[model samples]
Target: VNQNEHTPTGTIREFVALSVRSINFVMNAFAWIIALALLALALYLLYRWGTANYDYFEQRRVPYVLPFSAYGRMLTGRLHPVDAAGEGYRVFPEERFSGFFVFRQPGYLIHDPELIKQITIKDFDHFVDHSFNISPELDPFLGRSLFFES
Candidate 1:
């Protein structure tokens, strides 16, 4: 039953199997390459999104504090709200306000209490909503809370 037979059909079958495996390997390698490219593109887009508001103040012709990546100036602002506000305030102390980035969001920091009072009180109608509204679907409690509601 164990005859040493060098059949041409057996050789062709082995060659076909090897060819299929080679093709599969090449296809897998190409798929991996495409996946890596997409991952890199996603990461780059995320980085841009995180830093997109970095130049808002510059374009608006308002003085602004230098920002850090991803978290913007918010990282420092969160830790030291008064000091951070003062830093932006001093940048253009003579002016009424200066810009600061709360993460990717841009907002003006008023240096004078009178200006703040005018904006918050006298002109309250125009700017009724103080807190930024988040998605209720994403965070049910905080997003729909009275504190966030206008």
Candidate 2:
């Protein structure tokens, strides 16, 4: 009988066991990495969704102020100015931009596109400067412009 043929079955069993263990370890490692990647992706999506609407306000460091009254509480901050204006048109039929407060500062939330168009184009002279002490003669053309008027 050949010595190789007569080799112990115990050694063969040990080799098979070692191979299976290594395979299991590799598979588990891959599974854990995949799970971590999925978790990171989910967290990113959640962050994007949460901050989507408030991104501009966050960038400007503005505080959000909620309105009072039962109806205001129910609809406040949930509706954008455009949508709110649509509903207001049906109820109040107004054709002007509305004012609300952000912290202590007053913010004009525009609703009417035509009014906005006029303010930005035709009636720009009235709304150009927000500051009281600014002199148009000093800067002339640039000082009279709305964007840099203040």
Number of the top-ranking candidate, with TM-score as the measure = 1
Best by lDDT: 1
The local lDDT score (0 to 100) that residue 12 gets in candidate 1 is 87
Residue pairs whose backbone atoms clash in candidate 2:
none
What RMSD, rounded to one decimal, does every model reach?
A: 6.5, 11.4
Backbone clashes per model, in order?
0, 0
* TM accuracy, model 1: 0.61
Candidate 2 whole-model C-alpha lDDT, 0 to 1 = 0.59
- Model 2 residue runs over 4 Å out of place are 1-8, 58-150
TM-score of each: 0.61, 0.35
lDDT per residue (tens digit) for residues 1-150 in model 2: 765664678678878899999999999999999999999999999867654554443456543333232225446666565553344344334536544343234455556788789878987777755634446888787777666666
User: How does candidate 1 score on lDDT?
Assistant: 0.76
Candidate 1 C-alpha lDDT tens digits along 1-150: 344675888788889999999999999999999999999999999999888878888888987877663244456455465566567765677888888776677878788889888877778678756667777888998878644654
- Note the Cα lDDT for every prediction shown: 0.76, 0.59
